[model samples]
Target: MPTRDPDGIRRVTDAKALSAMANPFRSRMMDALKVDGPSTASGLAQRTGQAVGSASHHLKVLAEAGLVEEAPDLAKDRRERWWRLVDPGTRWSRAEFADDTAALTAAYAAEALTLQRQFERTQEWNANAASVPEWDAAAFNSQNWMRLTPEELGELSGEIVATLLRWSQRTVPDDGQEREPVFVFARGFPAQP
Candidate 1:
């Protein structure tokens, strides 16, 4: 299903497990856990705008797929339950699911959903950009068309991820500078338009 890599990412390679995470609600829950750390179903429900029962069901599904796990230690009592991402991040490649039709379909769905979510988040940021003057200089988007061999593309992807990991793992300074979670995502693929 999902194997932990040396980079601490969960590489999902199974159709069933991938399908489990393909749901819109489940995807949001996973994001919430990744961003905010371990949380109860009620907390996730609030963050994701889902009902408590719906959140619990999706969390169980995600746990069954090994994408998330129960955080018993974070629970305050027997009635309380908490969940956290099994890894810092997840990665899946369409090439990995090329052989199975069902897997390919699931992969496509997950990719499309992710792209849509990213676009929506960016749109929200754009709409509210005027209110955050401090971030105006930092917010950015860039694109360039280039030709590269598949091997070169792979290497480029690896390098980009390495750079992101460096930033992601750095500790925030104790200087009390105002800091907030910043959303960052990247995609590189062959395209002509």
Candidate 2:
């Protein structure tokens, strides 16, 4: 989830903003803001089960990166400062890496490793469970061959993003659900020679 302005538009788009989100703690803080609404540093710490100092540090980093903004403390608590996501849909691209093939390749490798680790952790948890029906309910990876022009591929990418966003918005059942966080990653490019 992202924090949106009154017009429901994102406001952050730059390398610094993107790098801010690359850190796990800052990213988690953004998630907290999105799911729980505006909060003070202490409130976010409580909600995310993070230490107050750690949360404050990350929040400050996010604020410096323009990913979050300090809001007015209407509660009359002078010591506490409220913060909110600047725009939930904010995105950034590493313009400096636009022509760096090695850097791009490294980024892809890092993402793939992250996905693999997530899968392995889930498998470990499932192995210990007596019945893992919910685990089975999720889909992991998919790849296919498609004959399409570059423009068509771009359209397909947009469609996939929309579908994934819809899925993310779906409500999960709360019947004692012990769900693990799952990551979904999809990458497509020209086939190798």
Candidate 3:
């Protein structure tokens, strides 16, 4: 189960909750809610290429797991229901679920699917890179291999999230001002045993 931290983050630490989040549809719905704010099942269905009923089912599954919750305020009508992410992002330790091979595989597979989707998005951006000169110039995609103690790796991960959260808190636009959303991803893991 997720517990709200002092910072108002619904941090998920339970293995069962992580397993519940391993489904592709549920994962996609969570990402959509995080990226696009509150929306209805129909809207998410359109975005995810799933039927409305399928989308609704996935949304309910996520809600049961506490990754998302109904946002009645965003609903446009009595018939429509709006949902949003409980947290803008979630973190889990694979090691915690490792003992349960089935759950661990599913969770890892979901992450792999997410990475593949991100790669596709990057390709799409590459196709349009020339039109957005500023973004193209500012974008980052680099990798380096280095040795680090496990403690150092943990600190690095925490620092990255802290920095991103500081920026994410300011994403709301000022009056009449327009801004674009930017995605920042970091992958730091030991490649050698």
Candidate 4:
């Protein structure tokens, strides 16, 4: 297993858990819980624009996979059930599942879904960027092409992740500043396109 970070990023090595989290809805639900904190099925449905029953079902699946857990303390009454992410985020590499063909397929599918979600979010922001001109200067899209060996590429990837982790761990001041969730993602791989 990979080393745990201070930010509580869970390293998933189990094939069953990887397969369980490979669903698009489940992935989004996990992200929602991580960002918005514990919430009930109805609240998750509202946030995800999914049916309440669908949200509930997915939450149960996630719980079974150990990605999320019930937050009894956050519930207002016995009837209310709240769910929260077991960790701030999850980390998995296809390399870990190389021995298992099925697990490797699941990991690939999960990675594809994640890339799709990131692209969709970027497109949505671009479409409505004019409505919030304040973010214009900060919003950015960047890419570069470089020649490097596998080892160098690995080092670069590690540095990028470390940089993002540092930023993620920073404490936002409670000075009434208008701040919203920001999504950050990066990819580095050998490309011949």
- Per-prediction CA RMSD (Å): 1.3, 5.8, 2.6, 1.9
> Candidate 1's residue-wise lDDT over 1-193, tens digit each?
4587678877888877789878999999988887788999999999999899999999888888888898899877999988888888888888987789999999898888899999999999999998998897788888878799999999999999988887877877999797888889888999888
Clashes of each: 0, 3, 0, 0
Instruction: Give per-model TM-scores.
Output: 0.95, 0.61, 0.84, 0.92
lDDT of 3: 0.78
Off by over 4 Å in 1: none
Lowest lDDT sum, 10 consecutive residues, model 4, at 1-10
Off by over 4 Å in 2: 1-13, 46-49, 73-76, 94-135, 138-141, 166-185, 191-193
Worst 10 residues of 1 by lDDT: 1-10
Q: Write the per-residue lDDT of candidate 4 for residues 51-76, one digit (tens) a residue.
A: 99999999988888888899999988
TM-score of 4: 0.92
Candidate 2's residue-wise lDDT over 1-193, tens digit each?
4444343445333445555666666666787787667998899888878899999999988888777898986455777689998774553223445686655454444345445655675687568544666556654557798888988987897677667666665687889967555556566568954
Residue 116 of model 3 has an lDDT of 83
Of the candidates numbered 2 and 3, which has the greater TM-score value?
3
Quality of model 1 by C-alpha lDDT:
0.87
As for TM-score, the candidate ahead, 1 or 3, is 1
Q: Which stretches of candidate 4 lie over 4 Å from their true place?
A: 1-7
